[model samples]
Target: MSEKQQRLVLSIIEFLNQSIADGTVKQDDREGLEVAVQCIGEAFGVDPNDESQVGRLSIKPASLSSLFDLFMKTRERMSGSTPSTSTPSPAASSSKVDKEAAEKEKEKGNKFVSAKKYNEAIEAYGRAIALNPSNAVYYSNRAAAHSFNNDHPSAIIDAQKALEVDSKFVKAYNRLGCVFDRIQVESLSNLSWRI
Candidate 1:
């Protein structure tokens, strides 16, 4: 990692440590924190569990202070505690892409779908949605997986959610129409059987 990148990872670790010490992070938040730590570890090419690697980062105190300041400012902006007047930095733009860890979960869902493991695919897609609710593709993929599982209601809901996220998501509309048609056919079949 470059010096700046190293400092950013270190700053995140420091923030985690401080939050833990202050008991600001609840037990429910631990899983999210763990994911953040794992991402940081991956970015820095270091094992978060290994204290020795942290020492090896050779982060100076001055750098840590500056990083912490930036971290706090970013946090405030994210929390809407401060208005974001300035344009985002390049690092910030890259970080936004990095935050889409949901992409990994979505890929897993796709693998499950390809294997015809509809239930597993739904579960993986659900996790992906939980991680990034605004991702229209995740919802659209999940909707298809739900249809494969013979879960028309869930498929409809997911497709609708995808449309809600991105109105121009044509695939979601197509999926939704398919699910509705299936439901209609099932209803007609049931009516004939009742006759």
Candidate 2:
């Protein structure tokens, strides 16, 4: 990594360390944050404990929070200077294309479901969901694929994600209910077998 990037990583490590010490991070997550600091330090080939590494950022941004705030302000300034236009910005155009692509991927997933290829269906729906995470139907479709694959845990998670995306989506609620029913039935079946 470049020195600039390393400096930034060092600043992030410093921030994480400070959070751990200041009790901003939960006690349970402190160890994981420490591990993350170690990994970031190793990845950047910089030692967080070494004062010099942490001091480099002091020239401009004393900490990661300040650096981020500076970045956001700069972004706001840049955005304000852009002229209003009828044509869409590149990012907005890209989002439109992504929505179309997500729909296509969802169609592919539906075809896979009809063919009883649960894994392929799951992968297709995953791509769709990744592209357009706001779409509850993609998540619900993935949940169905997971259910067909007998992956109850994944089905439950996807259903929950679907609900998160659109709370009023009845399909997600049904999918969640169905997964719970299936789990109950499986538990009963296993108990009966044991008996």
Please write out the lDDT profile of model 2 over residues 45-85, one tens digit for every residue: 88967655544433221246854643453344335542232
lDDT of 1 by residue, 96-163 (tens): 55446778889999999999999999999888777677778888999999888878767866876675
Give TM per candidate.
0.46, 0.51
- For model 1, the superposed segments whose C-alpha errors exceed 4 Å read 1-100, 188-195
Model 1 scores a TM of: 0.46
Pairs clashing within candidate 1:
none
> Highest TM-score among the candidates is held by which one?
2
lDDT of each: 0.69, 0.73
lDDT of 2 at 61: 16
Q: Native-vs-model 1 lDDT?
A: 0.69
Q: Residue 173's C-alpha lDDT in candidate 2?
A: 71
